[model samples]
Target: MKLQESTMHQNELINLNEYLLTKGFELSEEEIAKLVHVQKEICKNLKWIELDESKLYKIILPYTLSPYLSFDNKMITLENAILIYYKIRSMFDWHLDDETCITTCFKTYTSLYGIQDKELIKTIIIGLKKEGYNNNANDFNESF
Candidate 1:
């Protein structure tokens, strides 16, 4: 995976929270604590923290989002986008126990969002083609 530099911001956090709310994924106190602890460590480390997909799934266990999407034709939903954002965000440096960490988080969020957007557009085109809307799919593909 390519790592693009991004700055985390308050709006990104707000957007993630809103997305989670829509998905009915509210973090428990314990989960919040764990998130904070992990985030602090990431920030303090100031380097990439290794987190494979399984560890990523465990970190986001509070959410109902599944981590087992098939690679070839995987779809990126809001949940996937948010989680991917966090996973990347966890690898960067930031301020511990402060909202200032938003900068690092925002960076990861935007990068992941770009990747996910491309995935989504490709998925949509595939769906359109499968539904026999070849013309529409071709038009959409051209738009990208």
Candidate 2:
């Protein structure tokens, strides 16, 4: 049940690709490979803890997909995506508390990346909520 043990699978990749397609992105093989590699790195860097696959996917998918999400009609660069992933991962490792992890990660990412897009923030909040995090839309209202 370790985080690394719940690494992304082929089905998940397919699902991710399908999800992206629904969002108007058709990822090439290279893009899919890059996502897999980055996701592995993200999981590898995290501390091992008992986490269910469903919960892990709910928590991690947003980080994996964030780079592709259009904010003000611009996609976030891969470099920025990796930085944001690690920043959130680092916070998760240090805090080890789901109650504050999402909020802290959101605050830190925005402070460093200067992301002010409401839709992107809402997507992240919704994803985290799927993992059963207590934070809600109200937690982010003042920021956006």
Candidate 3:
């Protein structure tokens, strides 16, 4: 998917760590490195990275975040807006990693939080619908 903003979002990722601090956890660079290493190792074990089959999972830049949520039928509820944004960014792994599969991750992950951020979610829902994802934008709020 095309990022609306042009910046690398490094500063935004740093800001996410600060917000995560209040959520009872700290996102450390060391931890992030380890996580990526582990992820890479797992990819290797699955033969997805070094082997063939188009390497379904791709690795690119790394970011971190923590997420929390709540919901009702009328409006989705979130514990923290900032947290969700951060989580969304990290979950965007498959999105930012490659152009072709970007939409796939974005569409599949919209409701992964179990709670939708009305504004941002509205944008994504519409975007996914336009891209032809199988999800009905209006029906999403039904699970809110």
Candidate 4:
């Protein structure tokens, strides 16, 4: 799938930004663009290839933010953003970086955060189902 196709719409993105504001995070448009870019980059780069664990962490770290900060230059990686979103909101841990894991994390975060726009969540759940994460997909249906 194309990157933008699987990403949030502009208004949904704004909702996300607004949600973040409630958590004391206010990402600028530029930062949000960078986040979208980085997520696309990671997905494109890792689509058919697996990185070693350390390399994967290295690749993912720049996108992570310090949790204590209200604002910073560092942007959250899509994976870590999902992880942190769940962590902060529900105390859930989403630690894996594989495609299914990331997609599920995204679905969970969006659902729990009240994103409400079902297109992205449906897409992510479909992707998970295709990957044989039927249980996970069912959980999303139940939870969201």
- Which parts of model 2 have CA positions greater than 4 angstroms off? 1-8, 38-60, 63-68, 71-79, 91-94, 97-144
Cα lDDT tens digits for candidate 1, 1-144: 233211232333344355455554544445444554654454455454543423333333323333332223222333443343443333223423212223333333343443445454444334334534323112332221
Per-residue lDDT for 50-108 in model 2, tens only? 24444333443454445435523222443344434443344323424643554445444
20-81 in candidate 4: lDDT tens per residue?
66667666777656755654564454352323322333332223323332444235334455
Clash list (residue pairs), candidate 4: 63-77
Candidate 3: tens digits of C-alpha lDDT, residues 20-117: 55554554556445544654555554454433221211212111221332112211221223223323323333323343333333333344543334
Q: Which is the leading candidate under TM-score? A: 2
The models' CA-based lDDT, in order, is 0.37, 0.47, 0.37, 0.43
- How far off is model 3, as Cα RMSD? 12.2
Residue 124 CA displacement from its true place in model 3, Å = 14
Residue 86, model 4, lDDT:
31
- Regions of model 1 farther than 4 Å from truth: 1-19, 47-144
Q: What is the TM-score (0 to 1) of candidate 2? A: 0.40
* Candidate 3, superposed: residue stretches over 4 Å from native: 1-24, 48-103, 112-144
Better of 1 and 3 by lDDT: 1
Could you estimate the TM-score for every candidate?
Answer: 0.26, 0.40, 0.32, 0.36
| Number of the top-ranking candidate, with lDDT as the measure | 2
Global lDDT of model 4: 0.43
Specify the poorest-scoring 10-residue window by lDDT in model 1: 135-144
Residue pairs clashing, model 1: 6-107, 7-103, 7-107, 8-102, 8-103, 8-104, 8-106, 8-107
| TM-score of predicted structure 1 | 0.26
Q: Cα RMSD (Å) per model?
A: 15.5, 9.3, 12.2, 13.1
